[model samples]
Target: NNRPHPEYSLKYNKSRENRLIAESSYNHVITFFEGLMNHREIAIPIKHIDFSIGRICVLEVNRDITQSDIHILKTLAKMMYPLMISDKKFLNLETSRFDYVLSDLMNNPKPNMLLMRKKLSNFKFDLDSNMYLLCLCDLDNINSKSKVNYVKQMVQGIFEKHYVFVFDKNIIVLYNNKNSFDYFKKCKEYEEFLEFIKNYTLSVGVSKLFDGISGIRNAYFESLSAINFANRLNCIYSKEPSINFYDDYVLHDLVYDFVAKKKLHYILDSTIINLLADNNTNLISTVKCYLDCGENLNFISDKLGIHYNTLKYRINKLKTKYFIDLKNPDSLVKLKLAIIALEISKGYDLDLGLN
Candidate 1:
């Protein structure tokens, strides 16, 4: 068992010791470089080499460098400075490299259209049927600025292979099948998803999904409508089914155009606001009562427990102020649109005139 001679044993021990020292030094250097690289405020120092040539240079660095190393660094720097000045085109190319990197990241398809369709097939989302797109966004309760990033990450985690886009302040999620709807609706896990979102101040909205890219605009609007409905009703899910934009194209277009152009307040006035405010802004009661009363003076008064004269005065005042005729059927429809638009404008900054 003790076959090694003294010289052999000594050599083995020295070799092992050197190996350990080398490993330790390597690890130390790696750690030092990592720390330096990760330091946010640290920058490589650049020095002017020649004013006439507009040459800039940076020295080669070595830890505990000797005079020879410094001299070599200076020589290298001098050479590099002239090249840098003479080849400004390369510097521009370097700048373009960063732009390319960003573009690649953005377009590299974490989940592209083809991938999304394939993944959705696993979820049994029918490509041929009418679908709905629902987007759920969660806001950060602690740091407001971090909300978008946090929601983006969360959405990415949940919808791993789905395409997501950040439009303004909201995360846009696209869903495209009846199976997808049923799955989300019936899954017990959905409750957990809802809970997780709620913890981060979340909201969910579902849209009527159409067949193509053209339908996407409608789906987006419907999802937003669902969001507005939920907010007004104080409910998590919308009670009504998604509205078909095609079926009601004219009215939808009018409403959308008016809202897009920011002219909704011309059809609703302070009286409507005061009434809504007085009723604790109860959407259903206000809307239903307004419609059921046949825009009649006496009927609304009795239902709302106000004098008939008071109702007439309020109605007349609203008509004059907003220049809207509630008696006409078309104008009445427009009034309803105005109400919905006002509710939708809550979390958004809309220049509705009455506001």
Candidate 2:
């Protein structure tokens, strides 16, 4: 090939040099940005806020906040703070105000801005840094259309530094602040919350409080986990920690739907009652053994101090009475599901025998 012209070669070299320079500069800028991000101070905005019982303080005030605005903020804070501290109280604020505040906050689309300032200022309590969420509310069991609104109001009435959100037909109350999460954990409030749910025929769940907004997604899932746990455990309340919601949602939906439609009891009642009766009403041992042996009659019988033939006889009797064949994999699945359904429906009671 003929030698390239010097000018052409020089021009090409210059272009290549500029491209290398630009790439080097771009890499330098990226490194600098990464350093800045790594070293940037992460502010815990509410650190100074005292969240102790009966110690109320205004957390923030919006800039250019008007006198009417101040009155509204103070009124809301004062009204809501006491309610947060005292869950027994009902809040009856002007419906317009409530709607306006919630709408504004949700739409603000800013971090720690005027809407947050307004909302936080009205709440008189401090948030515990290590908050856990316990969502206590009924599912679609609300008798009246207004009851749904009432549950929202009840949740708002209990709002503190923690964020409260409604997931599905349930109200999720975030319990945060150092000792706040501990309060529920200590008072066995989780259990009590479950009892309240049972009284209302509601399903409830608890989420482990992940810190901050990033953790909010985790908290939401945790709340979902609690709901799933409740469904799987078949109780009004559950604190199950290992439920994989993504894997279990479909299964839970089926069980919840069955229970809601009143079909679960019919499928499970006869089998559960028969199992209980055959086991001499020793509910715990029977369930434990049945579950332990994968519902295998021979294994369950060997473990339960019963003869294998006797176990086989009992299983057959249950199969006949409930129209469920324990030998069939599909039938076994249905029977297990029915047992879980009855367990949850009866608040995890081992003595009820599916009645």
Candidate 3:
């Protein structure tokens, strides 16, 4: 469209006109405008077209408006609508294939690498380089699809090279490895994202950087393990959104495996069994905190919001009644293992019976 005044600019009023187009109720809106210098009248007709994925507006500028012109424009819009809808469906179909193929590859214990490469060739993914896997878990569990798509968009806005998809109701992001994945943790965008989702109660689990396509399944499990540990530790709901790193949980994986193989009652000693059976959760929490704090009295007191005297009293009660010697290396080890075993039992909903 040509303007009567070539030097005149409508940039200042574009936002207001766009708002008018967006908020209008009708399928099409027409507005009359006079040229800046020529004073010639013009008709600007706009038609908002809807597609499966999103909406777009079709606009035309005409010297005069008539029923025939309106019909022609409406007819053109109607003709273009189905093509746009078809394109959207085709795009969605291609995207769903990516989702399905990735899920299948992740689930298969041993996938055919050649076939995998062929399958994903069209997605233009860089499977040859090292990458980091991230899983975003929605605490609410409802609206999984919508939340996944929203998070995917947000992540793409920040990451330039990545493959993002949804699997098992959680959003999975495959970020091409930078010099260090730790860079993402410190980036301003990540902090802003955490702030953005603070109200959504989301937890993020990130895998260590892994090499190539062969390591994807391992990375997937690593991310899931991070999420598992975060939930077991009650970090999901107790604080702001958490971004758990698998490297941080590698040491704990040994204890996790130990508890996974043995029954909690069989693993815990008589003292811990009796302590748990006593039904004083506060005391149990204090003991866990005491062990976690490495027997630092002041730290334990501060962590539990109890006075030093109260903390000492609780420690004495455990020593006298439960015969737990915090000074003894063997006893301390047993106590620490018992705390973890109990947490696994409770957090993972395993058997809690003493028998």
Candidate 4:
């Protein structure tokens, strides 16, 4: 056993020498410990014996150690090394396979789109069985890369059915829906998701459900839109911002979609917008509340924390100054739509008297 093996005489090129040097640099310091991780009763935990590439775990048994038993164990250990190395290599390849296909789809989507999709589908992902929602997290407030990685691990553990990735410093999620849960049911989980983001100074945007591979681009756009909406919502309300779902802002997305389809961004009246943007007084808010509350002045008053008489005065003044006849159902609807559009478009920056 002390003699040199026959393979030691092999010639080395620059690349081989470099590989040897790199291998030598990594501290493979093997650690031995005996303990029970929970209830399993680990007999031996040989930590990082293969340069951070492998760990050996052999659980304790009832029998006493013998020379023959040790020899058999050593033989088994030698046999496992090759399999362990191969498994590690396969896992690395598996982990990075998605990255290559996704990069191709994002960067050059024209050629082999179907082929790339097929390639993606072959990799343990079933398009038909999986419902997808895209998520984008804003990590501007996250202090360090270690924190980002920790967040990633936490999210992955939390969202087990999700495929989480980091692209261009943003965490992107391709979430798989549970077949039993509907949109709102699945969304209940976000309470925890958003809470995590809030505690970690993170904000996230979640896309609406998309059924198939073709909808991936749409889902991404939805996530992007939700992020913008979330940021706007964060600034508008004093409440802490954590997540904004695109589905929650259905009206805003609808408006944008309508404009996109019609190639007309100016469908809403400029005068109405100007009035909403003025923020001169509380008239716009009063009108919005009146319409929103179905003309229930008392409800609106209670919500706004204003006196009934004060709300009435504001409503009457809104009708007078804006030339909006809240008395007419059609006019009230128009005013309400305008106010919503303004809220979606400008948040509180334009004010529309809501402040």
Question: In model 2, where is the ten-residue run with the lowest total lDDT?
Answer: 40-49
278 in model 2: Cα distance from truth in Å?
28
By lDDT, the better pick of 1 and 3 is 3
lDDT of 2 at 212: 40
Candidate 1's residue-wise lDDT over 1-355, tens digit each? 1232434322322232322322222111111222223221111122332112221222233444445644565466556665665666432221223223323333443525565455446645454566666555432212122234445666667666455555434666665454546566575656655655554456667665467443555566666665554554443234432222222233444555555576655554554544433443333344556866686656767887777776666666556754445677876675566555554444344444443
lDDT of candidate 4 over 103-219, digit per residue (tens): 555555454657866898777766655555556464443222333455566677767766776554456677777552255346767577766666555666667777765666667
Considering lDDT, where higher is better, how would the candidates rank from best to worst?
3, 4, 1, 2
Give the number of the best model, judged by TM-score: 3
Model 3's lDDT to the true fold? Answer: 0.66
> What lDDT would candidate 1 get against the real structure?
0.47
Task: Report the C-alpha lDDT of model 2 over 182-273, residue by residue, as the tens digit.
Answer: 45445544464444444344555556545543344455555666565545564344443321323334455456556666555555545554
In model 1, the Cα lDDT at residue 85 comes to 57
Query: Model 4, residue 176: what's the lDDT?
Result: 72
Task: Give every collision pair in model 1.
Answer: 131-209
How high is each candidate's TM-score? 0.38, 0.34, 0.61, 0.59
- In order, candidate lDDTs are 0.47, 0.45, 0.66, 0.55
Residue 51 miss distance in model 3 (angstroms):
18
CA deviation > 4 Å runs, candidate 2: 1-128, 143-145, 149-169, 177-185, 188-192, 232-355
